[model samples]
Target: MLTALSIRDVVLIEALDLDFNDGLGVLTGETGAGKSILLDALGLALGSRADSGLVRHGTDRARVTASFAPLKAGHAALDLLDEAGIEVEPGEPLVIRREVKRDGGSRGFIADQPASAALLRDVGATLVEIHGQHDERGLLNPRGHRALLDAFGQIDLSSVAQSHGEWRAAETALAEARERLLNDVSEREWLDHSIAEIAALAPEAGEEEALAAARSDMQKGARLVDEMDGVDKLLAGSDGALAQLRAATRRLDRLAAEHPLFAEALAAFDRALIEAGEGEDSLSKAAEALRFDPAELDRIETRLFDLRALARKHRVEADGLAALLEDLTARRAAIDAGEQSLADLESRVARSQSAYRNAAEALHAARVKAAAALDKAVASELAPLKLDAAQFRTAVEPLDQSQWGPHGADRVEFLIATNPGAPFAGLMKIASGGELSRFLLALKVSLAEVGGAGTIIFDEIDRGVGGAVASAIGERLSRLSDSRQLLVVTHSPQVAARGTQHYMIAKTSDGTVARTGVRSLDAGERQEEIARMLSGADITDEARAQAARLMEVV
Candidate 1:
């Protein structure tokens, strides 16, 4: 409930502070006395758009602050504050402040924490619903119509909504699975051909390096064989000098006994002959080793080329051919199983669709039953508010199957017929401003216990009708205030007299400027204000007496 409102330098409201209580509080003033200015100040504090024009001519800024006490502990606004890490004093009023400077810069705050105007609007939504001639009635929105129907009907539809959501999720999952399987099936033949082609190559690790080494050895052997044969002919042929050397060494050895120096020469010549023989033997063994076939080199090169060509054709390195083959084989296997898996997914989708249809049908039926009850309740509230000729209705129409949503397969609209001969039309189209106000009043009184807002402000709701109709509107407002705080701006004496608290908004002019001020009126003062509303500027004796009677009756 709104506890207090403070305004500073906002238009004609130079400085004003007002306290409110939990009951019907009416603000009464003459034409152009700044009643609208006060509402605009409250709207600014509630996060409406700010304007530099709102600042008084001599002031640099304008500020409006609204304080509220949550009727319960776990309000949505409190939850938002908790999420933002803003602390609120227990049992203390929550203060929301908005400031607009002359330069068009604006700032908003909640519990002293700097905030955005949008945040204040969101929190203010949970605290108050201000209905006026030009206000956007959130309840009238088509998007909110279903929830409003459910709230008015007092039906718990959350479980049905949850079940419908689950069905939708299951159906979505099944459709995705089937789509994947269909794509896999389309690629099955290609996958199988790739797998077979890669498997035939069967390339092994390190085979390329080993084949290259063998080829190198064979190519070198062909050249070395010819060199070894030339060396052998020189060392071991019939005209070889090693034989002559042997004969010379033998003749030297015979004279060694005559001379000791000659013996040394013979010993050296014999060592030379032995070394030459060992050289011949080593050349023979090397020639045998160098005699490799050239065909062996050709065969090794051919095999190496085959393996490398296969690697290139498959677009992989020689070592990667093995892993490539494994991947293709697995893809082929998955493709082979795609059809069966797709069939299974199709069955699952069918079951999910059935479940969704069943849940939606059940919810639709409940809404039909609930809509009827709501129509009757709203119709019952109309007669006393001078809407005897008006007819209230909850129009529930079935939506197309493809258009079905989480709420249900239905579209709900609040319709009305304002006169006896008129065809029923949407409430927004059929009702005039005063009729809309009365209809809203009836709707609110009907759903008071269901959709809870801490404060409800009605700006001139008692505008068009008078006499008994005014009295009925007052009684309902008073009744609504029993459970929820209500603030009303009224011109009707009956409505003003119904207020447990009355505030008079009056214009006062200083020598230089005119300003607006509000004062909470005592019982005697309230009678005078009511008398003023009843008789205008005149305030006749009979009007005062009637005002007293109306206050007493309310």
Candidate 2:
């Protein structure tokens, strides 16, 4: 229920705060009293498009705030707010505010948190339903019709639908796998050939690197042998320095035994002779190591080249040959098992199609039964609203099974005939604006308890008809209030009298500016307002008596 509305600098409204309550609260006034302005302000707060022209002449911005108290802790609006990342404390009122600047920019807020207009609209939809000349008419929507039928029948088809969805998803996955396997089967011979070729290669890790090293050593071996042979000849030939150094070292040793100066020379000569001998031994080892068989080197180089060429041809690194082999093996296995997998998938798809068909059939049956009852109820309501000749019908057409959707496998539309001998057509296409409003009223009265919670505001529901028809509309509004809050703006005295609370929207002006204001009328004030509505701008004794009578009936 809407608890309060505050408006600041919005067009004719400079500053105002109005509190609302449950039941049929009616706002009545003469033309140009700003009754529509009040509703527009409320709409803006509920996330309607913002207009900079709505701001007062001297004001920089206009703001509207609406507050609602949810009937339960887990209302859908609270959940929507939670999803929007807006916090709402338990037991606290939900406050939604919208502001528009003079520059045509606007901002929305939910629970004091910055919000987008789109999000505000989403949350607003869950809390209030506004019906007007061009606003949302749930009765005309087939989607809403299906929901109403389910709610009326007290059926929980969501779980069935969920199961159907899961089954379909599994079937789809199985079908994709089967398709891949079938494709593999067509290429089975090619897969087998490729797998065999990769398996025969049997490439091992690090073998490529070892072969590369062996090839490099063999390629450089000839030059290294020539250099080592030269070094060996220089260090070990008889004419080489080692023989001469040995004779010199022997002469130095004989002198060292006689004098200290010769002792230093003898020590140095001995160290030089030992160093030369070590160099000769190192050269001999090098020459022996440089010796290699030419055929062996050529064989190693050819093997390395073969491995590299294979890696290039296969579009893989030498080290990745093992992984490639495994992949080819898996492909071959898939080909071998293809027929079995395809059969399994076909069986699963068949099962899923059957399950969905069964569930859809059951739902269709339930809708047929529920629609009959709904049609009868709505027809009964039409008589009192003065549409006795009108016939309300729900046309359920079976759609293709393959086209079945979340709703079901049927296209359900609400059809209506306004007069006898007339063919039924969609209500929106056939009904006039006034007729549509009354028809909506009838349908609402029929499905009063089935729809979800939130405030329902009917703007001038008494547009075309008057007298008894208006009274009936008022009576239904009152009835609707029993389950949910209803706010109506009307010119009918009967409607005004039906309100648990009455308000009058009036235009007042200071010397400089004109402004619109709303005030909750007391009993005496309400009677006068009702009389005014009954007698135009003139309030007569008879009008007051009639207003009193209407009040008595209410």
Candidate 3:
């Protein structure tokens, strides 16, 4: 329910704050008391279109805020709050604020979080509904008829919607499988040849890097072969270092053997010759390791070339060749089993279609039954409001196959005939003025529990009737307030008196700018206000007595 409204510099309303209570609250005053301005301010906070003219004179901007505290956990507005990523704690109120600048720019906020105007409007719709003589939204809109019917009947449409989704998915899968099969069959030979080419190379993950490294080593060895050969010659035989060292050591050995010091010198000469020979043998082994195989190099280069060429043809790097082969092999396997897979997919699609059709039929059946009960319920409400001859019915019609939707295959509409011998037509086409207003009220009462918002404001719903008719409308509005909050703007004293709380919209001036203000009326104050409504501009003693009687109506 809407708990409060705060308006700042909006048209004739300047810095006004009003707190609202639950149940029926009526606003009554003389003509041009700025009641419409108050409604406009509330509408702006609810994300209605903003006009630059709405800003008060000399003010830079206008702001309006509406606060609501839904008593029920499953109130539809709660889902909208979650969707906007706005969290409302256990005791917090949902605050929607709107600002309209003098230059025609506007902004909206949900719980102080900036939001798009469209989202604010959607969130607002779930929280409140304002019904009047020419309403085109909510219950009166034909586009939302099916949803309203489903809500009224408490129908669970998830099964039908889920089955339809599954059916679409299955159909899509079958189509994709067929497309793949057709493509693969047309290119079967090309696929076969490609598979063989990759298998023939038999590439490994790291083969390219290894081959490139080996080629590099071999090429470098070829460049340094001459220097290695010179080292081998210096350690060779005869005139090489090993042979010259051996000849010098032999001449020193015989002189050393004649004395004790000479024997030690001969042992040193023997060790020196042995070291020279070992150096010559190490050189020989180093020369042998430097040997390069040109043919092996050629083979490695050719293999690397083949691997790179295949990778280029397939648009993959050499290392990816292995995985690519696996994928192609899988596609080939799929081709071999394509027919069976296609058949299985077709069977699945058939099953899903059958399931969707069954669910849709069930929904259609449930709506038909609910429609009958709703028509009877609404019919009972019509006569007491002075429309005993009027006929009301909920029409359930089947949609074409192309029009069938997730909700089901039926289109629901509320049709009515306001006179005897008249054919049933849409509610708007046949009814006008008081008849139309009463019909909407009757329909609203029938769907009050299921399809209404938490806070409903009726803009002069008791417009075209008085006396008994006015009392009947007030009684229903009072009854509606039992479940949800209702606010009515009325000229009828009876309707004003039915309200659980009364507010008087009055315009005043401070010798500069005219301002609009609302005051909640107490019991005696409410009686005077109703009396004013009863007697117009003059307060007569008889009007007060009648107003008191009307105040005791509930």
Candidate 4:
């Protein structure tokens, strides 16, 4: 609730401080008495558009401060402040201040900390609701209708929101899976052919190098085999070097037994034979090792060519072919598994859809029931406000699946019919200005415990109505005030008389400068004011009597 407001050099308000209280507070005065100026000052504090014209004639700047007592714990406004990194201590007042300079620029503060006008406006919305000829929020916007109905019905939307989230998640996963499947379909045939070719070749690690080495050895051995055969014939053929050495060693051994001098010559001859025999044995083994088969050489060359061709086709090194083959095989296996994976994702999407449908159906049912009750309650308040023939409705229309949202699949709107045989239309379209205020009043009274701000200010709700209609408006205001604070600017005597607190706004001049001043009226002062309202500019004895009677009833 707004606890106090201070205006400094704003328009004709030079300097003023007004304290406020809970319940219905009324501001009453004659025309051109600056009641609108007070509202303007309040709007400025609430971050409305700033203008240099709002500054007083001689002042360089104008300021307005609106103070509110601490809101209830967990208020949405406090959460907004927290999100902005602003600190507000518990049990402390929430002071919103705005100042406009003559240069057409303005500044705002919340709780004495610098703030943006946007933030001030957001915070102000949580503290007070202003219903007038041009209010865009509250019961006016159809966007807020669903939440209002939900609050009135005490419906919980957590399950609905949760289900919607799950459904969207499942939907997204399915979309990605389908895209992957489409891409894979284009590559499926290529994958099958490549896997088959790799399997047939059956490339192995180091096989390419091993085959190349054997081919080189066979080519070199073809040249060396002829030289090896020549050396073997030289060492082992008849009458060759080894045969002559063996005959010389036998002659020397027979001579050594007959003559001592031949002993030395026999030993040298035996050594020569031994050396020649070793040379012949080495040549024989070399001739055998140099032998090569033409068929085997052809096979090695063919194997090498096959391996190199496959490596080029796959755009990899000969040694890397085995790894590439393994990778492609894994890809084919994954494609085979994709079918099962797709089935699981489809099942998940179905489950999520069912969950969301169940929750939305339940929410829609509750809203339907609540809409009927709200209509009934609002209809009951219409007759007393002179809208006896008018019908108030809380219309819940079904929405298509594409329009469904986290809230539900229903579009809620407030509708009204001004007279019999009149088709129900939007609240804003069908009602006149005076009728709209009364309708809003009736709606507020019915939804007293539903969606509303802590404080509500109605601008001239009894603008053209008087007599019993004025009395009815006053009574309903009083009733609405039972739950929350209400401030009304009125010219009606009946409405003025119902205020628990009364203020009088008047324009005064000190010869040079004119200013607007507001004062809290005492009991006698209220009587005089009410009397003035009843009898115009003159207050008569009968008017006082009537005022007294009006005050006595409430």
Candidate 5:
């Protein structure tokens, strides 16, 4: 509900402040008493388009601020404010301010936090629905029809939307899988041949390194064997030094028994013989190690060539062939099982589709039932608002497959026929300005508890209607105010008398500057204002009596 409005230098409103209350409040005054100016100021605060002309003469800028306090939680405007990063504490009023400069520049704020006019407009839509003869907000938009209908019927659509999303996800997965299968068909033969070739090779880890070392040894075998044979001949052959050393040692041992110098010579010869035997044993071991068959050397060289060739052909190192073989084998297996996997995916898609179809059908059925109830409910309101001849309808039509959405596979529209025997058409197309306002009111009354802004303002809803018709309009507005705050700008004395709170808009001049002001009417003041509306410029005793009677009825 709008809590307060402050205007500064906006047209004739030099400085004005007005506080609002819950329930129905009506603003009444003589023609050109700045009632429209008050609305313009409110509109500017609600983020309507700005114009430098709106600024008062000689003023640099014009500013308007509006405060709203939603009595209940979970109002849609709160969500919008949250999304915009505007803070509104519990029990705190949300303040929106707009300033238009004489230079045609403008600024806006929500909760004193700087905001864009576009965002302010979005948030304002949830706070107020300004219905008039030329209304474009609220029910005038067809986009919100489905959601409004669902709210009216108390239908919860989260499950249906969730199921639809899941179905789409399943269908997307199946399509991608099928596309992969079709694209890979030409590669099936190539994959099979590669798998077979790699399997036949049976490459082992570290085989390449072992084979290379053995080949290096085989290549050096002939040179190593020749060197060992030369050492063996020098150390133990028939002309070798070992035999000469044995003869010398025997002579030295005999002389040593007679002379001490001989003993030294015999010991030296013994050491020489031990050294020669050690050298011969070392050479024999080397000769055995160097030995290699020609066929074995040939086999090592051929295996090395085979490993290198295969490595090059596969664009990998010889050591990596084993890993490559495993990958090819896995890919081959996948192709072999592709058909069964695709079949399983198809079954899953079918199940998801069935679930989605069931949910959509159920939603469609509920909408049809809800639409009929809504039509009847709105029809009941039409006759009281002086539209007994008008026919109200809720048209539900099936949507094409491509148009089927998360909500449902149906489109809902509000239709009307203002005269008997007239074909029903869109509300905007068939009803005149006055008829449209009444029709909107009837529809609003029917769905008063469904989806509506916290504050609703009707501009001259009683236009061109009088007597009982005016009272009926007032009664409906009052009923609507029971759930939400309502404001009506009217000249009808009966409607003005119905306001829980009455405000009189009047313009005054201080010889140099003219300004607009609004004041809340007290009990006695309200009677005088109503009487003025009843009898025009002259408020007679009879008009006052009638005003008292109207207040008594209220």
Candidate 6:
């Protein structure tokens, strides 16, 4: 509920403060007495569009602040604040402040923290619902009709939302499966060929490294084998190094008896011949060990080239080719099994669709039932508001399958027929300005127990009616306020008389400057104001007496 409103330098309203209370509150005044100014100031504070022209003449800026009492924990306004990333302390009052400068720049604040204008607007919408001929939300827009009906019936759509999500998810999975099958079927031949080529090569993880090592050793051994031929040539014949060493030993032995030096030389020559013979034997064994088939090196080279080429073709290292082969083989297997996989996905999609259809059917039936009940209730309110010839309807029309969604497969709208046998049409199109106001009132009265904002403001709701009709409208407003706060800006004395609280808006001029002011009216003051409304520019004794009677009747 709105608790207080403060305005500064807004048009003719400079430094005006007013406190508000629950139940019916009325703002009554003569035309051009600045009653509209109060509503405009309230709209500004509620995050309506800002205009520099609204700033008071000779003022640089204008500001409006609206303070509301703490709301229920899960109220729509609180949820809106939460979604905007704004936090209010528990038990804290919600204070929304908006300031517009003369240059058209504006700022909004919630609880003293700077906030975006959009956030302020969104939160404000949930707190107060202003219903007038020009109002575009709530009962005016057909797009929001479903939500209003659901709120009215206390209908929970979470199950439908969950089922819709599951259905969409299943459809997505089916689409992906179909796409995969299409793509894999197209690649089936390439997959089989690649797998076959890889399998034929049969490359092992360490085969490339082992083959390289073997090739290196063989190439070195080939060089050694060529050099060993020279070794064999030097050590094989009688004139070779070992044979010459044997001849030297014989000559040294023949001269050994001639001197001791010759005997030592003979022993040295004998040991040299023995050592040369042992070296030749070792060289022969080494040459035999180096003997290997030349084709073995060629074969290793061929295998390594094949492995490296295939790895390059597949964009992998030689060692990774084996793993790539496994992956391709698995893909080929899946392609061969694509038909069954698609069937399985199709089955799941069908099941999900069935579930959604069942849930939507139940929701559709419930909406139809709720719409009938609402029509009946609104019908009960129309006669009292001087709309006895009119008919109210809550149209529950079925939508096509493509339009089915979380809210179900129906379009809900409030329609009306202004007279007997007249065709029912949308509220905005068929009803006149005055008729629209009454229709909204009757609709609101019917839905009063179920939904709407904490505070509802009606501007000129009693515009085209008087006498008994005005009294009936006032009675409904009074009854409507029993559940929530209601404020009516009116010229109807009967409606004004129904208010538990009353404020009179008046205009005054100080020679050169004119200003608007608002003050709470006491019982006697209310009587004078209502009398003025009754008599128009003059308060007669009979008018005052009638005002007293009007007040007592409500």
Please, what is the whole-model Cα lDDT of each candidate in the order they appear?
0.83, 0.83, 0.87, 0.90, 0.87, 0.89
The sequence of per-residue lDDT tens digits that candidate 2 reaches over residues 20-123 is 98888999988888888888888888788888888989999999999998447677777887887788888888899999999999999988999998888878
- Candidate 3 residue 94 C-alpha distance from true site, Å: 3.4
lDDT of 1 by residue, 299-389 (tens): 8888788878878987888777778888777666766786677677677767766777787777778888988888888888899999999
Measured by TM-score, how close is model 6 to the native structure?
0.91
TM-scores for candidates 1 onward, in order: 0.79, 0.81, 0.82, 0.77, 0.87, 0.91
**Whole-model lDDT for model 1 versus the true structure?**
0.83
Off by over 4 Å in 4: 189-331
Clashes (N, CA, C under 3 Å) per candidate: 0, 0, 1, 0, 0, 0
Sequence-dependent TM-score of model 3:
0.82
Task: For candidate 6, give the lDDT of residue 79.
Answer: 81
lDDT of 3 by residue, 1-554 (tens): 89999999999888888899998999988888888888888888887888999999989999999999844677777787787787767668888999999999999998888988888888888888877667666777888888888999999999899999999999999999999999999888988998999998998888889988988888887777878778868866699876777777677776776788877877887897788678768766766776778899899889989999999999999988988888888889899999999999999999999999999999999999999989889999998888899999999999988887789989999998988989988866755766877888898899888856888988888777898988988899899888989999998887898999899999999898898889899999998988888887889989999999887756
What candidate 2 gets wrong by more than 4 Å, as runs, is 56-61, 70-74, 78-91, 101-103, 178-197, 210-293, 400-403, 464-468, 509-513, 535-546
Please name the candidate that would achieve the greatest TM-score relative to the true structure. Answer: 6
Per-residue lDDT of candidate 6, residues 161-273 (tens digit): 99999999999988998898899889988998999999999988988899999999899999999999998888779888777778878888889999999999988887887
Worst 10-residue stretch by lDDT in candidate 6?
426-435
- Which whole-number lDDT from 0 to 100 does residue 145 have in model 2? 68
CA deviation > 4 Å runs, candidate 5:
70-74, 87-91, 205-262, 279-324
Q: Look at candidate 4 and give me any clashing residue pairs.
A: none
Ranking by TM-score: 6, 5, 3, 2, 1, 4
RMSD of 1: 5.1
